[model samples]
Target: MRQYRHFDNVLLVVFFSHPRYDVNLDYYERTYAEYFPNMVFVGPASREDAGFNHSYDVIVDSYGSAENLTNPEFYQMAGRMAHHMLFTVMKDHPCYHGYLWAPFDTLLNVPRLQQFDQNRFWYHSPFGEYVPNSALESDQDPDLHAPPARISPDPALNLTEDWKGWGPDWCDPHVGLPACLPAFRKAPSSQHRRLASFFENGTERFLGGSSDTLYVPGIHREAFLETLALFLETECFMEIALPTTVHLVVPPSERILFVDHWWIWQPPFNATFVRMKWEEGFEVDTFHTFHWGDAAEGESWRAHPENIEDVRELLQESARRQGVRLPVATSQVTGRSPTASSLLPVDQRQA
Candidate 1:
């Protein structure tokens, strides 16, 4: 991603490891060191190398670590747990303005890079206006993480009222969560528009949508961390839990839905517009996720991406959106033919 000049401004790049590979974090750090100097790896395995990070690890968010990888509930909620764990590692290193969470196979639209530029990352987030001066000005260059307001809560606990109290004393004000998420049941067999958890009040609706890729800032850091607990408590998948939890936390006075969802079919998108991330999307933070999961029971014709071709096609379209073609980004390092899985992510290729 550093191939693009805009990505050069990214202070730190973190790779959240899946539980299966958490045992050998140093190997990942040593192997990918050439890509970026400030890059680091976070996972359950890093627990073994305490010298590599803070003394503790994020076991709760590691999602079953190696024990419950096969458990569907634990597996689905694990994605959010990864975000929580990443937040834990990033809080100490306040050089970054915010964080972007995308799949290993994901690609940034060449044009979309401007929105995520270091100067504009906070503005493009959900609560852009809520950003504090400490995050923006740093006029005196004070310790952004260890502000005087921070109460030094026990970091050992996985779930808490405000995890690290990022909002209570750090931000402008703490706008409490919504009374409850709102949505209606769409009956069984539907992809969305249904209840995520078995609530006590029998509310059959929820704020549900796609969450494959997202960007968040310090304002909601702990709220994002508590999402896994909410998911498990609600007994729903990440899709429902994430969106509902996110919207629920937005301050009512500033709540707005920037996300866009789609129902797509076909793979390795043959045409320019097929399965596009919305032909005319939100100009500033336009983002759409192609459902990479299995087709619904009756919708057998839907294109289920089995390999990386669909992802490469997505990147090709991302380039086209900027009136350009996919560049030979890997050639700079490999010095080999650009055809050598240039678009295929290293992790997937190795897997």
Candidate 2:
């Protein structure tokens, strides 16, 4: 992915972790820090406070949100913190134009994403294939990236998980909490009202896209993140909370660029797929997520972790996707690097 273009100058590829789960943050930082110095690790303070031989540029608080949302752990409440999280990074390094919210296990199609306009908001969806004959079209064509007037995906299937949410009008914030109490005072700004108007006459629906590989431009991200946090205040599913906010909070919806790819739905393959192709060995068309699984046998297809910069080890949620030791990603013995490149991540080099 780095070969086609150097994302170090264009975007910040983030690998984030929640405190509840376990992943070897130090191993990853040490392993890829030399070549992919552009990347950064984000873990909860608890993980750092627990005293691991690690340091993170961006650290987020683990809200115990899965329990709070009464939803699955996969949601990660990433949508809730997107706003404040970026602020933490952008405050010091103003050079970055965008952020890609990806988990440690994710493998993005850097070249595929780079072909499009980085200035626009980016997301890929299975809800509806907006790009016709997407495989044949040149993703770089200026005409191909325009946003539709309104994208109404299959009505029977809503993008937002209506089944697993509390409300924009919930009676209590503690609905799923240990104590019963009122929460998130229905403080609807006119924009919130517009958001409410979206649901009042009809149910609020989601634009619907994978939580992974989401790209919010710096210009629009703050608003997008703020709205996403608002939705989290209601305990909306992160998947739904994300795209819904993308549709509502991001103005000039025309700027919302959805990249439709086969890799997104089940992606190029399931999380269990193996055989991490060599960095130069991969095809340019696919982002090719690393083959992930946790048995001692599962590690073999991991793009030859010993030789490549692949850090596809399964973390808590990803580890559970197949089978695992429970909380942490399957452990591997990766020696840390002694040299920190001049390319070291902004937060690392500057801070």
Candidate 3:
């Protein structure tokens, strides 16, 4: 077991990469060194480190097989591997205060990086309506139900009536990919119908109204997954295991905040939100990290260098406010190249 030296509330940014996106890592390192000096980057050891001493708080051992949509089991294994990596970090570095795990393409916008708060998990609510233990197994559980409020399913669509029910806090009017909505309405699978009903009903009922949008910020991680798993087992709803619900996690407390309007599958929407963040100056104040999901897409941070620069400036400013200097490095460090092993065949890797 590797012993990691203790640090005050470290920000752990996670990523898995291929050869083509190595440049993304290079730029990320440079930006981190220049702008956010207080933070440390942890990643895998490379072949080039033959005799060289590289400093990293943690290193992921196996790269695991790549994911493919066509093959369900392979894809599921890949996701499991990703989750394992996160769990490894949590287990090994319990002393560290908070973690911000994201794909490599994620960018930092503000200079003052908000340290993670362990007590509260931050992420964006997938369902626009906030429902309490709706995520939990039963409404009777005191741990899940808190209060009641009127929630509208669609914030985009104006509904005059608000329905009262038990639900989580933090409902926003952001439904993912419009195309997905039709599928839910047509086939009406439990997952699909739940999504459609959320849109149609406009309000989620539960105790303790929406937690607050700022609470849930980013990708679904270990804590949130565990919570969901517990909820599904209790409710006997196996569909929650589907990949679509990956982002649906509990609402975060005000102390722990999540920057919003970013998703893994959607690109144009994320770009638009980023632009909005830049315009409003909100990005400078609150956000520390920006995830550009799916390196293969056109909306990737790699494709939008200008946006990356905007984020870089934010990180620099944040560093200055925090009174910390990022480690400066001149030599270029490239991430591992994509290989046959790295690229698990679509048939073998899809889950």
Candidate 3, residues 87-189, lDDT tens digits: the string is: 4444444333455555454544332234434445443333322222221244233223222223224423322233222121112111122222322233214
Q: What number of clashing residue pairs does each candidate have, in the order they appear?
A: 3, 5, 48
- Can you tell me which runs of candidate 2 are displaced by over 4 Å? 1-6, 11-13, 17-37, 46-51, 55-60, 65-95, 125-204, 260-351
lDDT of 1 by residue, 223-256 (tens): 4445434444322433444454444444434433
* Candidates 2 and 3 compared by TM-score, better number: 2
Candidate 2 lDDT by residue in tens digits, 226-329: 56555555543444445555556555335455563223334334323322322222222223243332224523122333422333332222223323232222
Residue 4 lDDT in candidate 3:
20
Candidate with more favorable, higher lDDT: 1 or 2: 2
Instruction: Estimate candidate 1's alpha-carbon lDDT, on a 0 to 1 scale.
Output: 0.34
Model 2 residue 80 distance off true place after TM-score fit, in angstroms: 9.0
- State each model's CA lDDT, in order: 0.34, 0.40, 0.34
Which regions of candidate 3 fall more than 4 Å away from where they truly are? 1-8, 17-21, 34-58, 61-64, 71-81, 115-119, 125-256, 264-273, 280-310, 314-351
* Model 1 spans with C-alpha error above 4 angstroms: 1-61, 66-83, 116-205, 219-237, 253-320, 323-351
TM-score of each: 0.41, 0.53, 0.41
| Superposed Cα deviation of residue 55, candidate 3 (Å) | 14
